[model samples]
Target chain A: MTESGHSSGGGMTARLVAAPRVRRGARQKVGDIVLSVVLIVLSLFMIVPLVWLITTSVTTRAEAFQLPPRWIPTPPTLANYAEINSLIPIGRMALNSLIVSVLATAGALLTSTLAAYAFSRIRFRGGNTLFSVLLAALMVPVQLTVIPLFILMRTLGLVDNLAAVWLPATVNVFGIFFLRQYFASIPRDLDEAARIDGAGHLRILFQIMLPLAMPALSALTIFLFEATWNNYFWPSIFLQSNEQMTLPVGLVQLQGAVGGGPAVVVFAAITAVVLPVLILFLIFQRSFVESIASTGLKA
Target chain B: MSSAPVAVSTVRRRGIEGRSNLAGWFFVSPAVLLFIVFIAGPFVAAMGLSLFSWDLLTPARFVGMENFTRLFGDATVWLSLRNTFVFAFASVVTHIVIGLALAVAVNRPLHKVVQYVTRSAIFFPFLISWAAVSLLWKYVLDPDFGIASYYLGRIGITPPNWLIDPQWALPALIGIDWWHTIGYTFVILLAGLQTVPGIYHEAAKIDGANAWQRFWHVTLPIMAPTLVFAMIITFIGAFQIFEPMRIITDGGPSDSTRSIVLYLYQQAFESFQVGYASTIALVVFAIVMIVTLLQLRLSRRWMGHD
Candidate 1:
């Protein structure tokens, strides 16, 4: 097959080569080298700003704006980190963010998984109708809903509480739809067999089905955690006191040089907030990427 | 075949139909209850408040359609709409082009490691919050002490004031947005690129096609559907841009960077014009719906890769 196909396309290769055949391999090699060099240089450029942020975070105030731009600090101290740590209660902000993110993830998992099971496994009146409405909700930008959500939260007296942020985010339309698709793709035979053995619907979902769907569940957990961790807008509006601020909002207030102190202090605050998210991504980076790709394909 | 056994099972299933009804509701009640309390409930309340003017401190008066009328006449609202469109358009275009180019360059069949590293590096920006991103750019764009200015001075060209200057502020915001958002589009597009079969390229080569021609005919058509999805998502994200503009510019330099969301926030929360803010939100909603519908419609014409 190779020989036949090569002979059939032999004339095409000749026409494509504007130069001698002996140089073709050499040209392709040169192309690879040049491409590699270009990619390396571009990647470095892209990374330089982030590296600068890390460096500046550790640098003292005086050295932060030093002439000729000190690529590395002379005596890299944790003073800036220490200063920011005390100046703004970074711990409190982190705690607020943690509580909100943790609860939101749990709430999302419980609600979305159940909805997914209902949409995928159960055949009931208005089931498809409900699922379609959920899909349409994905198109409605959350901004459009924020105004109304704020009013409702205020009426419920949930303002300034973590529940204000957690409750609303739990209603993620995309999360429900995502898990629904994943569940639908699971073999129905397992579910049917469980049913024949006198298992109830909830029992089937929690026992046999949930165990088998761990991959999708784990992926959804990571997605939910990251999204909730990084949320800024609602938290900003809902929580009033500095004591209740999430990391994103707290980081904003923590910024700006303090009493002629070094800019590194602000950088330290930024670094502290970013560290957990960076670590989270690194740990689950493969599953995170795979889940995102799978969702795209499923859509 | 197993027709008789299947029939027996069907008869058993019919007998259990009444029992299954309560189970379905039991299984779905938690999600349904949360959706009602959180989403459906809020949506109804928001609409109700939009019809009345109230600041939580004061009693609301029912003023039907008055808020929307005021919203339509507000010039700032109109300006914000224009800024939002320009912001979303410029950023989405640059993101798609840069993302596609990087994906193709790094996706060479021989260098899997290189592809993985480059993609991870690009995707790093996405993990960082926009609040941090705004801080990073603030220093980089600072006119007096920013590295950008110093580099320009070394090259004998005066640096443009990036953030403070009204004329450059929007472009500057766009640049920062692209730097942050290109990663998202890159990942989505790369996923799409991985699905395009290499067999098509070899066939095109056999048919005497040049490099550029092969990309145009084989790679692009196949990636069109993913591209549409990416662009629409990018458009939605761009339209809702708030944090970067709010944190970096604060709608400064004569409010040139005031986005629709920012404006709506000011109207609803800052000015305590709850009714007007809701009207503006409804307008924003209308625009999003129109754009999304247009995207869905247009995807039919050019987005097919099958």
Candidate 2:
């Protein structure tokens, strides 16, 4: 994968190789300048909405509604944040989201890694057929399964519970498929050596393969965490009560409850809902990009 | 003594192999169980439910093909389908064009800081949840004091009541969807661009191919598989777009912006037409499957991968 371009030397080598003909006279320079300017503008276009969201969240109600629109909050206040908390249990919703995302991530990682190991390493009966079935499930959108799953959950008396949100998500076929590919890339010699050393299958997986596949695991962890954290559709359906709702679901209820109220408060709630994930992305942007790239490119 | 020992070791090896097989099943049991209970079970149940007429409260009467037939005659179903197709089509074209262009621009050798910042800035919106994005756009497109209307009015072009106007609502939702998702398409294309082996471009240049020719002949062919992948996912996603419409407009302005999923939601929840909704779900499944297969089949012609 060209993800290997993470090295500075690779970039320099590419530049050095392309320097002569690509550095054609003033025309190329102008084109480069234009491309740079366009990219900068597009970048600003992307970032400005987020900037507006943060600014609006802090701005007073009067300032937020101003005709010209203030780019920055004058007399910025955390009052809206307080107001949002009062309107809905933002803290409680955040906690629910945190709990659900954490559990879902852990569950997905465990299931996917185990399944992937079985699929990749173990020569079990019907393994290919089972993997093919799992891959087929990948193409089936969750929305198509939502109605029956809802009924199933109802029958199981799991409605309005966090389990409804995380349970279905626990078996991520993409994660299984991804990790299987990663695990398959590891040489068979290690596992053979582990086996010769009297290491059991579980020991071989845990002690040898799992450690080598840490990058892939970390990537899957970030993907699963972000996906679960941001999931709104299933949570919206399953969690009806205010206390049970995740942040995304709660935000919608907040919008309804505070209809025609101060817009800043809503913005504050939006900011509150979005900030944690944004910070997570900023920290783990590389892994996020790498995982997405690997998935798309490999597929 | 050697034959006896060899036979004993062979038996032990067979025992170990059998144990490993059992271990494999044990390892995969949790995932398989969940897949059965959640995915495969629901899919089969949906098929069965679609064959019956039932609201949650009533005893379901078997109606065979009645729901499917009704779907054919249903005006709102057609309307929502049309809306979904329009949204999906527009999304695919715009995301591809804009994403590819952005990827090309960014693929140029730029300052490391500039590259990182640009990538992060563009991809940031994708990291945010659809709920947050939908609300943020709603605020931005608010008719009364929205910055969008404010800015447009300044330029002597009055923006329509975006979410309220039927004519504007779907377009507004499409624009919001683009804003939220273009980052994903961009990143994918950028990754594809990185894998395009600079030598191809250099080779093209040596053959006296101009920039446009090089891109058309070399860059595009290499990027075709990634492009198709992006397109298929974007279409699937766009067809299932419910969040923006649900949040921003509530599928309002006379249901002009209602996607098929939103319509299905309305049918199942609001109208309590679970059987009919299941039928719709099946339709969605079929459409996604057919479209995906069609794309896959057609892609072989243009895609370099055999």
Candidate 3:
């Protein structure tokens, strides 16, 4: 984009366009070659640890810490993967993580979008004040509310339950703030037109506003999914039972179970834990990165 | 559809009052109820709990100011407070410097491909779970059969026990903390870097400014708001550090690495000192608030990156 902009501005009018075009082509090729080499080297660094993790996971415990590390395991096996069930309820933990993440993401998106819509379009007494307080709520560290939440859950007899982990996280200030930032940008004319057609507020939000909010909603969903999936602290404290552990907590359990196993096994456990998230990231790298980047700028 | 809300049930004069106020309340009821019960109510309850010293087993008794008074006299709590502050500040400083450096280095227009790779490589660590990173580093830094120690031993240097020794443990934990979250800071900083137009750099170059001069004069000011914003988040996150210490040291080696959060966790969970733990949590909150205000005051003259 930068190079094209420079070329378009500098050489198009004075010199023959063909000569400048050739120079631009040469520069672009040179740039691409350098870029490819650099990217490959960097990409290798990003990928090698992952490759090592996979290799280490499949290798025997005895071969884990050979004086010189083995890049590949001969006769690779799934013994380590199989050990997960015997060691702990690893499959159940994965399911718990999936359930909690999906439910929290859905709940968060619904509540936040409703609140965001109300804040963006509706005018009520103390509405702006409430919104300002919510913004301040974003800056309040999670720890402030965490202790209170624990007590609340304990009092409600909801401790050690998945619902305890999912409820508070569902109504986050950041989600409201994020969706509001986007929703505020949506033109209000369509909303007014819908209202004139006798469409109610809920109808406007669903039929008119939501369709235009696909980009922001998708971004929010991706962000929420990643966050809830990776969330550790609340679940750690809330879910005391092994069966209820999420992937992050389960990985910790796996680490403990190894009880000083070969480095390869530990690496394997970590690999198992990180794999799903990494795959998801690779698939939605653009959305993952853009959601965060756009949100940060929105702040 | 024609019978929607019994539109014709009421007489014309009273029809305006026919709409259910309950419906509007119902629309927002779930969120309002959850927020009050889970957030606002707990926060108020915590404040009240901070004033008492109940262990959840004995009958409730009020002990106003005793818990806070005990906290003042408790050397361990004080030590934990200091350690927590140092850990938080060091990690925040390291993250900002290293993250900003990585962002600026890779933010260059000259090496677009290199920039992409550098950004991706740096961010790769951020995706790794905190426990995994902690375990990986614990092993790597382990004295026996550890890769880091193995390399150091070749030069006839013995590696100190990272999670065991009192003096070295906190620093080791800090180093790992920096590594775990530096990618997050870098990503945020890089996003900020993307917004600064290249035209400013071009104009600076036309003025015959050196690279260092251009960065200090043009880039820094433009990036100030972002730097401040990232710093605030980093400060808060650092102060709340818990997972790694919980996994790696468990606040061991005579409790040198015990952070305020860890102390709170142990107090509440291990000892079941709910009231005392709430008090400690309040102190932690106070510390965070004061430090943030102080930092905001300090950054006012130079920092405007909000």
By TM-score, the best candidate is 2
* Best of the two (2, 3) by DockQ: 2
Tens-digit lDDT string for candidate 1 (A1-299)? 22443455567764445334345546666887788778777777676677777777778777786544677887887888888766678889899888998998998898888888888888766777877766766666666577777777787887887888887777567778888878888899998998899888889999977898898888778778878888888787888778888888888885555324656788788888777666777787787777766665544
Which runs in model 1 stand beyond 4 Å of their true positions?
A1-22, A256-262, A296-299, B1-15, B110-113, B298-306
Misplaced by over 4 Å in model 2 are A1-23, A257-259, B1-17, B295-306
lDDT by residue for model 2 (B1-306), tens: 769999999999999788877888998999999989889998888899999998888798999999999999999999999999999999999999989988998898776766888899888888888888988888788878677888789999978998888998998888989988898899899988998999989898879899899989999988887888899989988988888878778788998998999999888877888899999988889888887777778677676463
TM accuracy, model 1: 0.91
Q: How many backbone clashes does candidate 1 have?
A: 1
lDDT of 3 by residue, B1-306 (tens): 978557556564254333323334444455566666666677778888887777777865788988889888989898888888888889878988978866776675545656656666666677777867777777667676555667677788887887789999999998877766776788899888888999999899768787689889998998987888788778888888898888888888898888889998888878978788888888877767776676566566665453
What tens-digit string does per-residue lDDT give for candidate 2 at A1-299?
23333343557776565455444645677888787777788788788778888988898776776778678777888898889877788899999999999988899899999999999989877788999888777778777799988888888999999999988888888999999999999999999998898888789899999999998888788778878888888898899998999998888886663337677798899998888778877898888888777766554
Better of 1 and 2 by TM-score: 2
- DockQ-sorted candidate list, best first: 2, 1, 3
Worst 10 residues of 3 chain A by lDDT: A12-21
Clashing pairs in 3: B224-B305, B225-B305, B225-B306
* Interface RMSD over true interface Cα atoms for each candidate: 1.9, 1.4, 3.6
lDDT of 1 at B195: 90
TM-score list, all predictions: 0.91, 0.92, 0.86
For candidate 2, the lDDT comes to: 0.85
